[model samples]
Target: MDIKGTGAIVTGGASGLGGATAALLAGRGAKVTIFDLNADLGNQLAKEIGGHFIKLDVTDADAVEAALQEAEGLHGKARILVNCAGIGPPAKVIGRDGKATPLADFTKVIAINLIGSFNVLSKFAARIHDAGTIGGEEGGVIINTASVAAYDGQIGQAAYAASKGGIVGMTLPIARELARYGIRVATIAPGLFLTPLLMSLPQEAQDSLGRQAPFPSRLGRPEEFARMVAAIIDNPMLNGETIRLDGAIRLAPK
Candidate 1:
């Protein structure tokens, strides 16, 4: 759909990939609302982009519902929803101490990464499904963030992988279900992007990770991911598929 003048909601838009997306969408003339936990960053970005910012946990159903309503009150019904609220703390099933990992750790990742995404998308879709068509054919588009780890999970990535795997697993089915409403659903499985988490590491470490990708031979940039989001929104035929923005890299098991 044409992004101009449309209302768009992006979860985890305080920083990193979501931040770039919120900025890009706003630049494209969409009235954007950033949903994230970091009030400082979210508010700053929102002001910079001339958008709105709502601070809340993505897993909180009531908060999410309320945030959606507030966004609607500000920008009308959102026609674009991007699920970028997720975490990827690495942990093994069995630790070096020869003890099983805490189950809570695993569940926490699933809660925020998998279930959290579902929460936002479902509410966003409900708000827009009955809305009038955009570009004469589509009501809205939902883009979710997955990771290459879902497919090439390394050691100590069990929780992260499982959470992202759930996202990839759900994309097509949700797309099919939302299709009747003219809402398109898709996922992006990014390989190794230079997000805040990775940027905290030393430059050498970041460079090492960058080399993991073959062609570009460097870490993926957040704006590149944002551009992919724009491409998906621009193309009506692209739906229900998970695009790997990995630069042809199949991650090593590590």
Candidate 2:
């Protein structure tokens, strides 16, 4: 769909992949709204990009609804919703002591990574469907963030992988159900990327991670992820699929 003058919402747009997407969408003339927990960065980035910012906890139902309402008030209902609010704190299911991981740790990941995505998507789709077609397009698009862990989770990635797997699992069914409304759903399974957190790592560690990618031998860039988002947005034929952005790397069990 044409992005110019359209409305879009990107969760966790304060930094990393989401931030890159918001910037790209705004640069393309779409009215963008950034939903993130980081209020200061969100506000700053919004000002820089000529977009609005809303502090939101994707896991909080009331807050998400309110945030969306606030966003629509500023830029109409967003037809482009990018789900990028997630966290991955790795821990083994059974440690050296043979103690099982804390249930809370696992649940928290699922809550934020999986349920949080659904929370935003369900609300966004409802509003988009209610608003009907957008600028002659059938409906809208929802891009979810997954991880290579979903396919080849390492030793400490059980929770993280499960959460991402939920996103992958739901893509097709959700797309088929929303087909009538013209809302498409897709996902991106990213490999190691030079996100801010990773950038802080020692150069040696960073280089090691980059070399893990077979051919490119480098971590993916945030702008590259943003470009993929744009391609997915423009290609209506791309739906209900998860495109692995990794450079031919199936992560080894750590």
Candidate 3:
């Protein structure tokens, strides 16, 4: 879909993949509204991009609903939604101490990553379900963020992988169900990237991770991920699929 003048919402848009996406969308002339917990960064980026920002927790249904309403008030009903609000704190099912990991750790990951994405998309879909098509095109597009770990999870990533796997699992069925509403759903499973979490590590550690990607031999750029998002939005046939944005990297079992 042509992004020009269309309304778009990007969750977790303060930094990292979602941040790049919000900038790209706004640069393409889309009226962007960013939903994130980082108010300072979110507000700064929104102002820089000529967009809007709302402090939101994607897992909260009521807050999400209110944020969506506020965003629509600022920029018309959003026609594009990119779900990038997620977390990936690795933890072993069985820790070094030998006791089982706390169940809350697992549930928290699922709640923020899997259930959170679903909450935003479902609500976005409902809002646009009956809306008029944009420029005679489909109703809207939803691009979700997944991870390669969903497929090849290493040790200490059970909760994180499960959450992303759930996202990958639901893509097709949700796409099929939303088809009648002229909405498309797809997920992108990214490999190692230079996100804030990764950047916090030592430079040498970051370089080691970058070398893991076979071809590129470097970490994936946030803007590159943003570009893939744009490509998916531009193409109508790309639905109900999970595209791996990892540069041919099959993660090792660390």
Candidate that scores best on lDDT = 3
Deviation in angstroms for 211 in model 3? 0.8
For candidate 2, write residues 1-254 as lDDT tens digits. Answer: 88888899999899999999999999999999999999999999999999999999999999999989998998887889999999999899898899998999999999999999999999988877867886676689999999999999999999999999999999999999999998999999999988889999999999999999997899999999999999999999999999999999999989
Candidates 1 and 3 compared by lDDT, better number: 3
Give the poorly placed runs of model 3, Cα more than 4 Å off: none
lDDT, candidate 3, 1-254, per-residue tens = 88998899999999999999999999999999999999999999999999999999999999999999998998889999999999988899889999999999999999999999999999999999999777776999999999999999999999999999999999999999999888999999999989999889999999999999988999999999999999999999999999999999998999
Instruction: Quote the positional error of residue 32 for candidate 3 in Å.
Output: 0.4
The better-scoring model by lDDT among 2 and 3 is 3
All candidates' TM-scores?
Answer: 0.98, 0.97, 0.99
lDDT of each: 0.95, 0.93, 0.95
Model 1 / residue 97 / CA error / Å: 2.1
The local lDDT score (0 to 100) that residue 149 gets in candidate 1 is 89
Winner of 1 and 2 under TM-score: 1
* Weakest 10 consecutive residues of candidate 3 by summed lDDT: 130-139
